[model samples]
Target: MTTGRHAGSRAPGSCAQSAPLVLALLLAGCAVGPDYHTPPLSGTEAPQGWHATLPHHGSRMALAHWWEQFHDPVLTQLVEQADATSPTIAQAVGRVREARASVSTNRAALLPQLKGSGSATRQGGFGGSQFAGGAGGLSAGALNPTLGLGTITTLGAQADASWEIDLFGGKRRSLEGADARLTASEADWHDARVSLAAEVANTYLQQRECEALVDIGAATLSSRQETLQLTERKFRAGFVAPADFAQAQATVGDAVNALEGQRAQCAQGIDKLVALTGLDHDALNGLLSKASAQIPAPPDPGVPDVPAQVLSQRPDVSSAERAVAGASADALASYRSKVRQAVQEVEDALVRLDASERRVDAATMADAQYAKVLEASNARYRLGAGSLLQLEDVRRTALQASQSLAAVKLERAQAWVALYKAVGGGWRDDAPNPHPDHKTTAPTAQGRTHTGSAS
Candidate 1:
């Protein structure tokens, strides 16, 4: 009897323990899809350090606010204006909002849904009428006994609830994909900002360089006019030939042509700036006038030696990586290719930046040497010891050297901008999440809250 009593008591305990085990098995079965895993980079894919020499020994700068490093308030203001008004940035923001909505929709799908309905109706009859409501009927006679007319009223209400049970983890996987896409959209927004800033800076630099060239052209024209005057005086005294005088006139004509061309180039640059800043020509001119006509020196953007570290900071790369995470097995290969391309871009930018630095140094020395030669030629020509042909040749050489210097400086500045963009303008994976007003925590089937991963 004691054994029987003990066995009976243990039956409920066994069922209680077995019940949880059964529920766990069911839950495990519902988790049908494979969990996402980050792909690891091979040694060849991720280098220990950069192959090209690091600029300024990889000295770091605040890459996120890279424009501020130039110390050009005009540039900063222009970048800010572009950021606010750029259609590209607006599109990106729209995409981020769309992704955020998708996440909310998918998250809501994982929870229960409830619906309620209510209805009321009234009927009149000449003789009598009856209305049904919840197994009871209202008789017309109860409403009006004196007349043969009567009215009946009916009212009904109902409530229903449903839960989808997640049967095969499809909803969860969908939510995961939505979350990744949202992250990618945010990264894309940052990428747009970085690209726009780099473009604006490069255009601004070009405009300044154009103004400098205009100045050079004006000075050259003045010098040629002086040479023409000198040649004319000598020709009248019969000390120089008519051919020399004609050649001097042709030189002045060429200078005038070149100066006009330079002015046109400067004007075109201003037009581009106006378009980029969304400002009218006059307003843009007013802003540009505040700053001197000189190329803003690009500050060294500290690049990390580790390829993976640098890639992580790039918004495009981050977006690509998220794509890989969210992509199906069939689409994974293509997304991985984008990541490889991003790495190649960084390496290419580094090589160009290194080469441009060397070019600038060489060009500077050549410009200085040519200037001295031109100065000596001018002095000799003024003293009537050098031929006009010799003086003109020296002048041309000096001008070419100066132009080369300017071109090389522009190349170096462009390289800096490219490198800045390559490294992601200092954007980080941990940047603040977009649409903070939206809830990140989703309710689970068991009434527990699951917080989404940070962007």
Candidate 2:
């Protein structure tokens, strides 16, 4: 907070005599440790545009409160509940408070320290004995000897003040470090909240995806059961080979098995959500019973093409970057390496998202083609132009393709979730951006699209 004018300005007249000494001491009082500076990213890694692909265009994305973009009231409620209840978030908050207290402690060192003390003493002496020795012993004895053995009491109190002037600025450096650490703790809190929200979303999405798959399995099972019944009628009439009926029965069994697996997945998903939200099974089941199997698609947080811009939104990255500024050369390298790893994570998420999208496209195509082949096989079999084996084969292929497409869709949804997480979710321009060097364009004020852009 000191200005150059304040540090250099001299007192007038007689005071000028001590000005040089005062100035010398003040000049000597410089922060001893390395001053905090924002670490620079390699230009190539965070060029003008992010080297990664931009999903689509719109007004700039809002990173803060990003969970609200999902447009699912349940999701919003869940995230809020998690934030309020999560012990992890509570721990992070405690750390922030601790860091704030440390900053206050370090700052207090810059001022004079005052202490108060008091003491009391009591002494007794046989004054008569000494008087008798000095004067006539008989006369001193006649005078009350006990009277001379009086007790004396005394009390004293004092106050002290002392200060160690920050000659080498070590205290100042400590304060600076404390302030930086406080900032890092605050960023860590935000990072924790961001991570919590993402975790909740991912878990919730998984639950919903599990539900969708279960429904798919059940529907496929119902269709397979009907086919098996029809094949049984032909077998009973001796109009079809026993293998045809057995094949249909086996298909039904497989469907039953698949449905059981899907149900197990659903249960596991629910259990995970229960663990995360700390909700009882009955309450969670009731909450989800009202919800459809459709996945919750949050709005796309149109991640900037600039790597630095995206990195700025990540509180973890910001915390690490600040840490680097306060670290020694070796520690600085370690912190910087963490930042690099964070960037690499985002890159990996983007790659996975890309691959997931491709899988969805392929699965969609395969599902549609298989459906057509199954339909044609059914028609040909009904017309007595195709074997029941061909029909069953096509039916299984179509069902498998349908299930595969569902799985891919779920994977793509997860990838979208990961991408959102990797790109820093809702941490954005208008909020207290974690990155010290960030100054990106403001996010749009318009409401987000409910149908996730990834979908």
Candidate 3:
């Protein structure tokens, strides 16, 4: 009977040993949490071309190193400096590193965890009875020969391991979320770089425009001074009234005031450039001195293609799209909102560029007409058929038109800059789409296209 019982006990023990294997197999089939699927990109249904098409619709404009398109070495240098020194870019880089570290941390959860521990201890104790005689625990003076207390020493070490088995796929879901976040952070880093470059370019352009204004003010002042001198001579010789002389002097003063203001504006622009580039004032001055006084023409950026190209090139769009893919319902909705905003920004930039070009054309034509009028006035004044006031008025009108044209040219250039920034500053068309599963569409109809680069 005893032998039979022993054999039965052996079978029970064997079955108990196999229980863990069965449990593992069962857990393997169960995975918790909803599966992730890539979300469809929003606002990508527009046609290949922007609402406003460019003159060169067939050729593609490269936005990578878009600053180089301006052909300004100073602009190129400033962008490089901003990229290397900007704290914004550095912060973005740090975020990417942190996200990567988070991925590593969560990934560890997928594997079994093991820990080791060790300890050492010493203790001593004495029994009262041992120190006393055996006669009903007699007096301590009659101590037993065996009475003694000794310390015990022990050293021990152990290793323990455990695994969650991922019964409900919680760990898997967490890992997926981590991966998505990491991708988003990388996209953000790129976006930061794009934004930084655009800012530097814009600041550099502003400085150029300021210098151009200063030049105009200086020339106008010189012209006014010459006119004042001629008027003064006429007054001294009694050839012109005192009122006319006073008017000429006032005009010169106005010009001088305007020139001073323009110089102040130019200085402010330089200061801003210095701040953006993280360079010393003297160094920036050297770079500015090397650049031409005239505003450099904007590079001929080829026509923008389909909206999908925008999505691929724009880092913000890519990052937002990634967020939608891995985020919860609420967060996904927020990211979707950003997609539409991105599309709107591109459209707005194109419209502004188109409008600015028209203004430039109008200003140029007006300036030419005024020049002709000024010439006719000069001829009449020499023949004594026009009064001095009449000639001066025509000259002022011509000067005003020229100034308007200069300002318009600056605006056109700025419009082009806006377009570049809006279109992701030279993002490649073939850049990988965050949502690769969806097909991208293009615009069908073209209207007043935004063409030409800024100058």
Per-residue error for 242 in candidate 2, Å, reads 1.5
The Cα RMSD of model 1 versus the native structure comes to 5.4
Worst 10-residue lDDT window for candidate 2 reads 446-455
TM-score, one value per model: 0.87, 0.78, 0.78
lDDT against the true structure, per candidate, is 0.77, 0.68, 0.68
Q: What tens digits encode model 1's per-residue C-alpha lDDT throughout 1-455?
A: 99999999999999998997789678868675667766777666666778888877777646666777778898888888887788887788788889889989999999999998876677777754554455433333345667877777776777899987776777888888888777777777788888888999899988888877887788888988989999899999998999999999999999999989988999999888888889889888888888756777776666777787776776766676667666666446655675677678888888988898899899999999999998898889889999899999999988888888888788888888888887777333343444667654211111112235322
The model with the greatest lDDT is 1
lDDT of 1 at 329: 63
Q: Each candidate: RMSD to true structure?
A: 5.4, 10.1, 10.1
For candidate 3, report its TM-score: 0.78
Error of 1 at 303 (Å): 1.7
Q: lDDT per residue, candidate 2, 358-429, as tens digits?
A: 787898899899888987887787666888777777887887898787677767767776776776664433
Candidate 1, superposed: residue stretches over 4 Å from native:
1-24, 126-150, 426-434, 439-455
lDDT of 3 by residue, 278-393 (tens): 99999999999996456777755565467666645666665665566556787667666666676677777767777777898899899899989987876775554776688678
**Number of the candidate with higher TM-score, 1 or 3:** 1
Clashes of 1: 0
